[model samples]
Target: MADEINRAPAKVQSALLEAMQERQITIGDTTFKLEEPFLVMATQNPVEQEGTYPLPEAQLDRFLMHVLVDYPDADAEHSILRIVRHEQRAKQQSAPVAQSLVTQAQIFAARQEVLDLHMETVVENYIVELVMATRNPKAVDPELADWLEYGASPRGTIALDICARSHAYLQGKAFVTPDDVQAVAFDALRHRLVLSFEAEAAGVTTDDVIERLLSRVATV
Candidate 1:
């Protein structure tokens, strides 16, 4: 996983595009394919951060999701503090590290099961329409018509389906639902969209547009 990727140079960020999309990175004269279940997790600092570079749109599209990590609440922060103190105490005592409960094979099998989860045609169409709305916002609401410079690509469509199915599987459901799609839509589609100057000038954000589309789009 790449942390604070926005601190990397433009060329360094561009280099990751191929590895992320194809799961292969070429070095010298040889190209190597990553093993199964390969995933890339990159964290970006806000553009307003000092010395942070904005990732190009192409590189951004290679990512499946763009999750915004908010600060934890008081209760969660207290838990985190306690956990860190415990770890420090354990390290001081040289306590043995706990063994992993899940194995690589188990993770692979779980992926297969998530892929096998069933999705109905109506839900599939709903996913498509959600992506389509990003492209043609005018159809859903005229207020959103000029808010986007570009919409999500076909990759967004594929990501929405897989992520929704995975969400259902995690919930112990055998079938995908419209709610699952909506739950994951913002993260899956936010980075894929390019906002227009008009939207920016009006202080609109990708999340705002995504929320609007979700409310406007019909399930059928």
Candidate 2:
């Protein structure tokens, strides 16, 4: 599954999914499954659509994270240029950073720590409220009601919870916060949303709808 590209040719993508379905190849091995969560990082040159295929909604929903990588910053670009200028010298230089920041044991420990994060009833309710609002925006605000075509499913709620826990763990926190939930809300819910024709015609995007849901749903 990690090798599967959502933006590959339709036939290629279909073959990949079919292979997974047939169990021709196990997605993540037992060690990976037990250690780190399975994640498929796929990239497509957005500007080049000649041989590229758009990802189907079902495939998109299978992904827990949909991060967008932007262009490098000025400092990064300068560093790249400097390295290129000193290519001969750089070839002889060893990397200053450590090869691995955290070991497998540490990663497993972090996963356990993430699971131990305190999730109060109120926080759980807040997570549910956010997911439910996606389905029926009218309950949250009448104005957003018309913009939504379809609501998120129960899987969305689960995704939100896992992402919030991951966010908390990244911050070295023992407890999840409303900020963690908010930070991961868009990535967890955006792809799961099905937009209406009207919304598309109006140029409204999934990010916009998710933002509206976030604003309408209360933390407490």
In lDDT terms, which candidate is top?
1
lDDT digits (tens) for residues 6-25 of candidate 1 = 99987677569878988898
- Residue pairs with backbone atoms closer than 3 Å in model 2 (clashes): 135-151
Q: Lowest summed-lDDT stretch of 10 residues in model 1?
A: 9-18
Which digits, one per residue and each the tens of the lDDT, describe model 2 over residues 126-213?
Answer: 8999988988889988867777888888878888899999898888887888889999988888878888887888989889998887
RMSD of 1: 1.5
Global lDDT for candidate 2?
0.75
Per-candidate TM-score against the hidden true structure: 0.94, 0.77
Model 1 spans > 4 angstroms off: 95-98
Candidate 1, lDDT over the whole model: 0.91
Where model 2 places Cα greater than 4 Å from the true spot, the runs are: 1-6, 15-37, 82-101
Judge candidate 1 at residue 173 and give its lDDT.
100
